[model samples]
Target: MSALELVLLLVLVTDPFGNLPLVLAALGRLDAAAYRRAVVRESLFAFGVLLVLGWGGAGLLQAFGITQPALYIGGGVILFLLSLRMIYGNAQGAFDDGYAADPLLVPIAVPAIAGPAAIATVILLRTQQAVPLSQLVLGLLCALLITLATFLPGRRIAAWLGPRGVNAMEKLTGLLLNLIAVNMMLEGVRRFLG
Candidate 1:
């Protein structure tokens, strides 16, 4: 894939726009300055996690004797399920229950930013696409920068978009994800048959 395609895939899996409400809920109790700090901190933490996974995930897969086709099919299935949830599920209340008073990184960074789908995509890019480490790092950086930009002004954007608008956008993102997932699966099947 081209660098732009890699970045776009990373951004789609990151799903920053869809996770705006969750981020706001996680940091809602903090002051403005604290909120900004948390956003930056959590984003960094997420980047670190994704970087580690992207670099080391291939080794782990090899250790388990997993093949490229298997990884592609599994990743596609996971993304497909996530897209269905994004399209039809009630994501607004994702973090409504069992959240810390002063959240650190559990809800926002891990699942919201560097979730399973994102992690899987990073690994797929590294292994399936054989993206160079430098290019992968650059693509990840670009994607996370876009996510961070979205998060910094999350509240204002949320207000401007309104709940309904946000929901609409999430569904649209979901539709895109579904197409990507199907393509991934098709590639996997082709590889397996070949």
Candidate 2:
């Protein structure tokens, strides 16, 4: 794929919309001011993580003797399980408690936004081709910016969507995630066999 297409796919895999339920659920207990601060902080945190991984992830994996297929399969399994939780309406246990002073870097930023799929995508993109490091970073930045945009107006969105609407959206997102997860797994298997 072209660089722009890769960036777009990364944004989709980042799955900010899919993660809205989790982000909104975590933010539900916060006041408006706190919510806005948390969103910005978490977005930056996720971006930093992605940037680091984009630059150093291949080296780190090599140091640990991990293969690309392993990364793909492992990430796919984690995403599949998370998506299942969303589909079954049992996602609460998967999230941090609402009482967290700030769930900035944990559920919201880590696995929710800069998730396994996203991390693996960055690493794969960086290592699999002659693509410039700058371009990979650019893609990561674009994806994170889109995530920030989605999250900044979250309160208004939650209010407009209400509980049921959020749930429906979450289910749809979960379904999409499942498809991505399966594709990842299949690709991993193909690479491993080849």
Candidate 3:
């Protein structure tokens, strides 16, 4: 896939727009400055995690005896399941809300921002495509940057989009993700059969 496609997919899976309410709730008690700082810090931390997985996840998979086909199929299945949640509007409750008051990283950085779906998708792209490491890194950075931008002004965006609008976008993105998941699975099956 092209760098643009990778970045777009990454952005969709990251789903910052959809997670606006969650972030707001987690950091709601904080002052404006603290909120901004938390947003930047947590996003950067999440980016660090994704970068690590994108860079070394293949070796980790190999160490675990996972083949490329298995990675593709697994990632595709996970993404597909996530998309189903999105499409059915059940994704709003899909993540844990057990974040502590004025949370820093646990829910925001780990599961919300760099969740399993995002991590799996990045690892899958890095392994499945012959895209250069530099390009993959660039794509991830670009996507994360967009996610950060959305998060910084998350409240305003959420106000503009509202809950219903965000849900609509989530469903649309979910449909696109479902299509990508099917393609990934089909490609994996073809490669495995060969």
Candidate 4:
């Protein structure tokens, strides 16, 4: 993939829209102000997690004797499962109900934003690429900004999208994720057989 393609794929994999449910779920209980805060926090935290992965994850994996094929196999599985959740799981609105009484750090910041799929992607991608610390920081920030922009205004965004738009977006994202999953799985299989 070209550099731009890689970046776009990264964005697709990161999937700010896909993250909406988890974000809303985690902050759904809070008032608007608190909800906004939680959104910002989750996005920033996600950025931090990605930045660390981009900068140091590959080296750490290598130190532990991890191989590219292994990463492809493992990471692909994680990504597949995560993307399946995005595709076949609950209605998008379901996530907004649980956050009022719970902590935003758990359901929101974790698997929602910085989940295993993300960590594995970072680790796997970091193998073929080594982002400069500064570039990694910038990339993470850009993703966070996107997440923040989408999430903080979810109600309005949801309204703007209406049912039609949301459904279309979800389907498109799912399609893209399926393609990504297939590619990852193929990469793994190829390396395993090579």
Query: Which candidate has the highest lDDT of all?
Result: 1
lDDT of each: 0.87, 0.77, 0.81, 0.69
Ten residues in sequence with the least summed lDDT for candidate 1: 90-99
Lowest lDDT sum, 10 consecutive residues, model 4, at 90-99
lDDT of 1 by residue, 1-194 (tens): 89899899999998988888788877888888888899999888888899999999999999999999988899899889889988998565655667874677788888878888899899988888899889989998998899889989988998999999988988888889999999888989999999
Candidate 3 residue-wise lDDT, 1-194, digit = tens = 77778888888878776677678878878888888999999889988898899899889998999988887888788878877877886554765667676776778888877887899887887787766778878987897789878888887877898878877877887888888888878877887999
Worst 10 residues of 2 by lDDT: 90-99
TM-scores for every candidate against the unseen true structure: 0.95, 0.84, 0.92, 0.84
Q: Choose 3 or 4, whichever is better by lDDT.
A: 3
Error of 2 at 95 (Å): 1.7
The TM-score, computed over Cα atoms with residue i paired to residue i, of candidate 1 is: 0.95
Candidate 4 per-residue C-alpha lDDT over 1-194 given as tens digits, one digit per residue, 9 for 90 to 100? 44455555666677777766555555567889887777777677776777777778977987899888788878878777767766776434434444455464666666567777777876666675554556556656666666777888997887888756765666677668778877888998898898
Instruction: Return the lDDT, model 2, position 128.
Output: 62
Q: Is 2 or 4 the stronger prediction by lDDT?
A: 2
Model 2 clash count equals 0
- Root-mean-square deviation of each candidate, in angstroms? 1.2, 2.4, 1.6, 2.7
Per-residue error for 65 in candidate 4, Å, reads 2.4
- List, residue by residue over 1-194, the lDDT tens digit for candidate 2: 68787777677667776677677778877888888889889888888888898899889889999987888788778768767877886444666555475674888788777877778777877776445788887888888778878788866776898878777877887787788778878888988999
